[model samples]
Target: MENRPDKTNKNNRTMKEKIRFYIILTLILVTGILIIQTILKPIPQGITGVQTLETGKQQSTQNSITGLGFLQPQDIHQIDTCIGDLSSTGAINPGDTVELKQDIYVGSTDCLNIDIANITLDCKHHKIIGNSSSSANGIVSNKTNDATVKGIIRNCHFYNFTNKTSIYTGKPIVLKEGAKYFLIHNNTFNVTRGITLNKTIDVTIANNTFANYSTLLTLYTDAEIYINGNLTNQTNETTIYNNTFEGIGISTNKPYAIYAIYANDLTIQGNTILTSNQITLDGVHDFYLKENALSRVEIKSQSSNTTAGRIERNTYIDTSTAMHFTSFSPNELSNISIYKHDMVNFSLSTMGSGVEQIKIYNNTFAGPMSIDLGSANNCTIWNNTFYPDEQTQITTGPNSKVRNNRIQNGIFKTITVTGDNTTVENNIFTKITGRGIVVKANNATVRNNTFNNITGIAIIIGDDTWQPPSHPVNVNGTTVYNNTIYLWVNLTTNTTMHSLLTGLPAIPGASTGIMIMPNTNNTNISENNINEQNIYAQTPPNMLKAETRGIFGKGINATYTLENLWIHDNTINTIREGITVENCQTTHIWNNNITKAGKTGIKTENCRGTRVNNNILEGGTYSPNIILWYKTGIEIFKSRAEIIQNNKIDKYHTGVYIYNATNTTSINSTINQTQIGIFSFLSMNNKILNSTITTRHIGINLLKTNHTQVNNSNIRNETGYLNTTGIQLSLSFY
Candidate 1:
């Protein structure tokens, strides 16, 4: 009321105020509309929009995903979706690419069921986790019988998933029925069951990790990789390369790391598996498993075709049993080669039904090896090495060969031959506690083998009923030639050759350099050097025995006789008898040089039709424990129909002692420097013809004997003793 005098001026000022208020309101409305329009606008297609860029990430407009998700570089559709949304959307279309954005929490429902082909699902390093108690799977393919899904699934991380099915289902990633030509690579799986393939072909699994974790608690996680293919539809051309499997617990239900059945042309290369489970293969053919670090391998391939299988360049570490092979049925398995393996602590076992041409070469065993290849024909083991303080047992089958192997520091182990026509050649055995080689089969040849410091028998040719009662047949037609046996003796106790021969035993266990036992016939032992005189200078003795022989041809009893033995061209220097053949018939002992024989040399007792010719017996200091009757150059006791010809006997107590022998002839023989020459005791129909006998005491002696003749013989006794005679006959009729 005070300012009501100027109405026009007040009205004009009010109008100006109203105009300013309208302008402010209009500006606020325009700003709000602009903000709404900017927020509501759709992002452009074929472009990836990000508010902020990461360190190694770049803004791109080509709609392509990288890092194991590169299907087609240009036509790649990078779908930024979670793992749960892919399952909700049923099936990813063909030629579509889906990249997960966040970690997916899986429930009882399956995560991804791929039904279409040519799809790429990249998890992008996010974990697809299951509920701690759920029986859900991470990813599964189509279950149809004729659907072929060809796709690439890469860069996934799956954890805490457990399966409910009993038959290799509901795994972390499963390709089933007709899932073929797929690539699954660069995935990380933890605390979950691994991948499974059923009746698939041309699938490659590379650079994946299947590990066990302790954080999640679940059930029914059995095998790491299980591939099942039946007879009608077999899986083919599967490759698993450059993968790692760690801390995989063995399942008592189905304990295996990689189990395959009826698969062909498979390759498992460059893998590191650290578990106690087995890599079992059944009904597989034409495969290569190379360059792997494994624990165990069991093969039961039923392949009959001539295509080959190979397991090469593998390292087995810290396992009890490394490899086992069995059940190749119907026809023989063709050409399996196992070479270049390094076994830390393991055993290899094999059972042969239909297996042939199995070659094991260039391997090293750091511990003990128990190899039992049962009756496998044409098997070869060559160029292998066995380490110290370990035992090894190798049993060969028919037509098998063991060559060029170095087995050292063994504790009571041997290579046994059980089948026919086996050959053991060029092997080096050092510091062995048992027999170096045992022959129990027919036509087996042991040649060019060197035995050094063996505590037991160097080579034994016997039938069944030996220590190991598994041999079924008698040994026949066996030839052991060109073998060098050096028995070590104690150097500290042996100051002279006399002390070395008497004090310490050369061969331990009272064993011989070559022993031929009962039921062994048609044997040939030739060109062998037994118990070298200088063995003690090289190695010291570890043990002692009662006696040692160079070559012993033994028999069971008087009823069972060893027949048809030919022992020739052997050089034996031992502490006891050299070349003793007892209870034998139709035997030939010829051209042997017995040097440093402490007792009798070339002894034949209870034998018939024996021929000993061209033998050189050079005796040394007698054994203090042996009796006087046993210290002879050539002993023929209780034998008949014998022919001893062209033998050179020297430096013995008695040369040619014949006891209880009949129809024996010593023709063209020479005796030198002996105490008694041609001493015949209780012998009948014996003749010494064309013989030159020289003795220190008696030249020719006959005691309690009849029908003895000395024709064209030169007998000389050169001694100063009182009762020295050139020829003495006492209590005998001639």
Candidate 2:
């Protein structure tokens, strides 16, 4: 039974093999047919870089359709071929049409007539003097309002394009007002100054090569147009993308380039800008562009709602940052937008003035920080990259949100915020100068930052006030809170103002480490680390003030009125002036650690309503441990009313310089250190109650003042000169 089954299987295999052989034979026949047919067809060649007859070929052009295939060679003459004046045929008479059957040559500044280049035919309506060859333009239209010349002389073979003998004199097709619907295409030009036209009526110029143009094609902003498929090079932002750019330079030093001024809704897009100068635009509105390259660009201000202007997805690579803006005339436009761009390698060292708010986001700046914001405002700077060693990293000014950016390790300060109302958060300031953060303005929130191994001073506040105190940029409210600053002490050569106060002089009786800011009736500071190494800063001699000036209503002519300042709950380990307030009025300092402070915790002068309560002021020897120097702090040099209550003042040369006070009170406080705790002098109406005073010298002493009352208190540790009475009062008080 098995042998019979095997025989049947063999028969089945034979039948399958026979079918397979037949199918293979059929496939081979089909393949041969395709191969033979392909071989029989002729291949068309490309004409992109070729020229046909060098001289005139009295031949006829056989019109054929070879387009959309391998770009084929067309019959085009490369040399000049024209004799006798085509004009002498007849004075361009009315209704007379001039037509060339084959390609004609154009000469430099060649004239069709003494006055008019081409004939203004038959004083006619609907007259089109068609061009003969692929090139023909040496014509002009005069006394012609509505006219049309057709065909193209562009992207053609190279001919004598010297001495302005370009498609120069006029357009292979040019139109004037009332001249409607003109079509010009596919022309090549190499001229001193290329094609140009303006104040022309509706026209279309497409697929032309304005190459090696010492000065290329230009359509002054005045002309209304549709421009496409054109290649322009070596010029400013004059190559209008889709719309036409007014033809420029009729041979003048006046910069032979395109001008788009006072033009309404001239759309520009998909064009390349390769220039070192910025495009100058005035009175232009409703413009839009996408995916173009600009060396440097600028946008001026105009009437509000800078409407419908979008430069989206464009790439900018300015080597010199040559493009900038100035408000010679004011522009108050609304809706200006710049989004999704890649900008890199720019030398933006000179954008020096008037910049307005434009929505710029999702941009890449792999260059320097040259986009200065010294005078720009209300902007959104998000998702940008500032590569290391770039030139222009950060410029001046304020009210901007420059967050979520990655600016890598560089030699200088990566970003400097010198303006007001700016929020700098969630940014990585890595490998920067030890100086972590720098400020020259007021009313700012510096929070949640990472100063990665920055060797410079981490945090630097440019208050410029020392003894008394000075203001930041303006008298405005500012806050420095919740930041991790690491001040790295590197470069033994450059010493920093590690713990220094740059506010107004600590005016006796006033405040310190603070400013008299505007818009803020009072200032506020809280929850900060003063000893973080990232706070390693450098002393910029540029920030050095001229010299010293007096406090409020004193030698300073400016009226200083600071009321109700609150500074509380901050961890200040070591800083020059834990807090320095000068020539200010009314303050509150509560619950802060002045431990191991480089200077006094609270320093104020020429101020009033001063409350210094519940603070630990200690450990500052090289500097005054706790110095109330120069007529202020619980003392009235010029102002009055203060309560220095419940504080631990330790390790100070002179605890308090309570002098020139109109009214003062010190209650329930512990003073233990060298010299004295409460030293009063030249003050009035002073009262001390229920305080423990133990010092190396007389505990509570006074000098030259009035109404001094020292009540019952713990006074024991008298280490220095017991002969020095515990309570030394002036004769006036006695």
Against the true structure, whose lDDT is highest? 1
Candidate 2, residue 188: Cα displacement in angstroms equals 5.6
Give the 10-residue window scoring lowest on summed lDDT in candidate 2: 542-551
Worst 10 residues of 1 by lDDT: 49-58
Model 2 RMSD in angstroms: 14.2
Candidate 1 Cα lDDT to native = 0.74
| Residues 105-212 of candidate 2: C-alpha lDDT, one tens digit per residue | 544433232122212111111112223232444433322443432212222322233323333233333333232232234444433223433333333444444333
Per-model CA lDDT versus the true structure? 0.74, 0.46
TM-scores for every predicted model: 0.79, 0.57
Candidate 2 TM-score, C-alpha based: 0.57
Candidate 1, residue 664: Cα displacement in angstroms equals: 3.0
